[model samples]
Target chain A: MARNSSLVFEGRQTQLKPLFPEDVTQEYVSWLKDPGVNEFLEARFKKHTLATQRAYVRGFDQKTKFLWGIFDKKTKKHIGVITLYDIHPMHKYANYGYLIGNKKYWGTGAAQEAIALVFDFAFLKLRIRSISTGAYAPNVASVFNYKKMGLSYQGTFKERLLYKGAFVDQVWYGITRDEWLSRRKKLAF
Target chain B: MSTEERIKSIMADSLEVDRTLIKDNASIYTIAQWDSLQHLRLVMALQEEFGMRFGDREIPDLVSFAAIQEAITKKMKSHGKE
Candidate 1:
């Protein structure tokens, strides 16, 4: 449980380090408040201020929930965040989520590198066997990113979420350690 | 057919578009059919067609027709296919 203290995940373009509550900044809170940014996130429902964002950041004890700031290596700027939560010891699986908070970082491969780093960390470092995540069906970009990441389509939860107007399905994705290991090099994470 | 022709064929087949639409400036961002999902399929197609693999980092950059052509060229050159 004392592991990953000062942990840093080094990727080609992105560098990830554990985020403390104090690391939560005003800009970070604004990312949550931006409707364009949190369009598919449940956070859109909430009023996000510095206090709320810091409290959320403080909740990641790293025993169960882990959080890291995704920094751009070249600029050393915190571009977004990635998290692995709800770790189950016996089951050896965890749920994953990420956001490229800085819109300028979008489509710059920052998101992909951030995802690959966390997945590698969970599978290889944490010794987790499987990692899973879900996306709104209308979020075609997210669904497809998971595909390129080598995660298998697990299933669909029908009408699982309300989008702009009507209900939409939620698509689940998952990958096991062996599956990731086999593909990582060729995929070059 | 030549390697470039074959590459275009795979792109056309995978993206369900005419081979001619894959022009010099044709790009994943510009093409309606070349979404993220199709991009993966297109990458797979290129890999199968060229018998080469792209690094995970390279995959995202291989968006444009010219970029993909360049990647394949470099890979082919490394393998002496060029």
Candidate 2:
């Protein structure tokens, strides 16, 4: 909340606002607890309650990480979260993870719009050299969106993650500041 | 059958819709059954039927029937299958 000098990363259909502790509502906690919504999220491993999430929101290191709530423009309802974390100032890089808790927004270009804002901030404002992220191999829709964001497939860590009952490979993707800049210039956006 | 017709049939089968319904302009926005997850299945179905692979990055552009046909055509031309 403190680091958002602009206070918002506005997109066409969604906006990214600081996800402070007070923003942790019952519905938000429910999304974390929902198995379907959390299947690909690392947070799925831990049982989420209102207290734990609120605490997690409060204790985040704003200097090194940012947690933003992705809200639907029409309802102003929080649909999901996008996080930029593990920022290394000297290296000028960071990693990202996101979730679209509301299934209605899936494949509707909402996530692509919201994540573009993350790139707009991290690469343009922070001057981050590169941003990298990993996705569950089974999550084709998410991986597809990552690719649409111009994050090229970097590599795969075989059986590096656990799913419902067994192991699954995790695929990595990344994009540099220069690459992102060029892609955005060409894209309709 | 032409590759385009084959693709239309595959799309119809994977989504459990009549082939006539999937017009050239039809897309995820128009098809109720072509949800995000179902779209993944459609990709797999098309790949399996065509015996070609699509890059993850190439997926987002294949939202409409025409786009899918164009991609498959481009892929076929690249492989000298057309």
Per TM-score, the best of the predicted structures is 2
> How well is each residue in B1-82 modelled by candidate 2, as lDDT tens digits?
8877888898898777889998887775456556456678889999999998877556645777888998998988999988
lDDT (C-alpha, whole model) for all candidates: 0.82, 0.81
- Per residue, candidate 1 scores C-alpha lDDT tens digits across A1-189 of 244654788888889988988888999999998988999999998999889999998899966788999998989999899999989989999999999889988766777778888888888888999999998877766776776677878898999899888898898899999988876765544
Docking class of 1: incorrect
Query: Which tens-of-lDDT digit does each residue in B1-82 have in candidate 1?
Result: 8777777788888888888898778775445456565677788889987889886446756767788889999988989988
Model 2 steric clash pairs: none
